[model samples]
Target: MGEELKVIVFSLAHEQYGVEVEKVRTIERMQPLTRVPKTPAFVKGVINLRGVVVPVIDLRGRFGLPEADYTDNSRIIIVAVKDMEVGMIVDMANDVVDVDSDNIEQPPEIVGGIKAKYLRGLAKLQDDRLLVLLNLEEVLNKSEIVQLEQFGE
Candidate 1:
């Protein structure tokens, strides 16, 4: 057995995705968002989380998927990369699983329509299920993070 990675799993369009738990700040129910003009379409906008304003991106939109209406299961997953904390609007955030490091393998060219660049790897889970692990750095690159930081000011 290798090191265990605690992953926060979320779903988008019925496919499972995972992010390392340490990068997550908190997961919140869908809340009202203040839209920012001139930002990318995936950049849904920002939300007031507690006293801090955090930029949010629609995971579906980010992956270039067709837009869908929010529902009771919608959630905002607050993640930190470097010094910025941004929220990712996921269809549902409902699980945290411990995965063995050895179970992870390099991502293919594409998974669930998302490019491999934005993904870290694929985790082979029990019961023949696979979890798409996202590479946050590539998902929200430095330039984009800089753009989001401006909104926090």
Candidate 2:
């Protein structure tokens, strides 16, 4: 037996991805965003979240996947890495599961068009399903983390 990991599961382009539950602050529905200038296309904008402005990024765009129309299922997952908190837009966020740390395996070179650098590993769950674990620190690299921090100021 190994340490149990509670994961917040979300979907992007029909593929499943997971982030540690401890890293998630909240999950919100799609809302209007105030665009910022000079940021990358994936950097959607900022949203007023309970008096705090939070920067948002579209995971689809971040992964270089074709952009799709937002629907009722669209959600903004607010995740914190270190002192930075950012919202990640996903197709849907509807699950929370506990997985054994031992079940996680090293990620392949690429999975579903996303680069390995952005992944932590792949967790093999029951029923032969695989959950892609995102490396949030890598997803929001040092430079982007600095950029997002600026939005908070």
Candidate 3:
């Protein structure tokens, strides 16, 4: 049997994306955010989780997609990177599915304008479903990570 990667699948625009389940801290509903100035557009702002301030980012804007209004389906995917916890705004958090290791192929030069480095691989699932696996660390460069960590201080 091939190895499997448990991933949390989410929707952005019409495309589906996935991140390793082990990296996820928790999934939360839409919450009020305190906007921070001079940060990247994707860096929507920060949210207080149990009194712990966490930086929230918009995955759509981070991928250069046109922003969309938050609706009932929107969700915040909280994940940990290094020593920091960060939240990502997604159109919809879909499922926790297992993608076979053998079925994952390296992403092409560019997948929907997102850099290939930010992708772990592409999983072609049943019913012609395509899941783009995201590399959480690469999603935010070192500098960006540092900036996010500082937001909580």
Candidate 4:
């Protein structure tokens, strides 16, 4: 049997995206955010979750997609990479699936408007569905991680 990788799949702008389950700390419902000025446009702001003020980023803006209104399906995916935690606003928090490592293929130049560097690979699933596995470290730059850490301090 091929090595298995568990992923937390989420939807953004109608495209399916996945992040390693280990990197996903929690999945939360949409919550009010405190907007911080002079930050990157993609950085939606911060949210207070259980006494921890976490920085939130809109995946739509981070991936260069047009912003849409937050609907009932909207959710915040709190992911931790290298000791930094940030909330990623996604259209939906879909499924938790196990993907075969061998089934994951190299990503092309781009996938759904996001650069290849930000992606780990593509997993081919049932019914011709594709999961864009994300390299969380690459998805959130070092500076952004540092900024998020400051919020926690």
For each candidate in turn, give its C-alpha RMSD to the true structure in angstroms. Answer: 0.8, 0.7, 1.0, 1.1
Write the residue-wise lDDT of candidate 3 on 99-122 in tens digits: 889889999989988889989889
Candidate 1 least-lDDT 10 residues: 124-133
Of the candidates numbered 1 and 2, which has the greater lDDT value?
A: 2
lDDT of model number 2? 0.94
- Between prediction 3 and prediction 4, the one with superior TM-score is 3
Candidate 1 global CA lDDT score: 0.94
> Tens-digit lDDT track for model 4 on 1-153?
589999999999889999988888899999889998878899989999898888999989988999999999999999987777899999999999999999999999898788999999999986689999988887898977776677677
CA shift of 65, model 1, Å: 1.2
CA displacement after TM-score superposition, residue 89 of candidate 1 (Å): 0.3
lDDT of 4: 0.89
Candidate 4 clashing pairs, residues 3+ apart or interchain:
none
Compose the digit string of candidate 2's lDDT tens values, residues 38-79.
Answer: 999999999999999999999999999999999999999999
Error of 3 at 13 (Å): 0.9
The model with the greater TM-score, 2 or 3, is 2
Error of 3 at 65 (Å): 0.8
Candidate 2, residue 124: the lDDT equals 87
Segments in model 1 whose C-alpha atoms lie over 4 Å from true places = none
Candidate 1 lDDT tens digits, 41-93: 99989999889999999989989988889999999999999989999999999
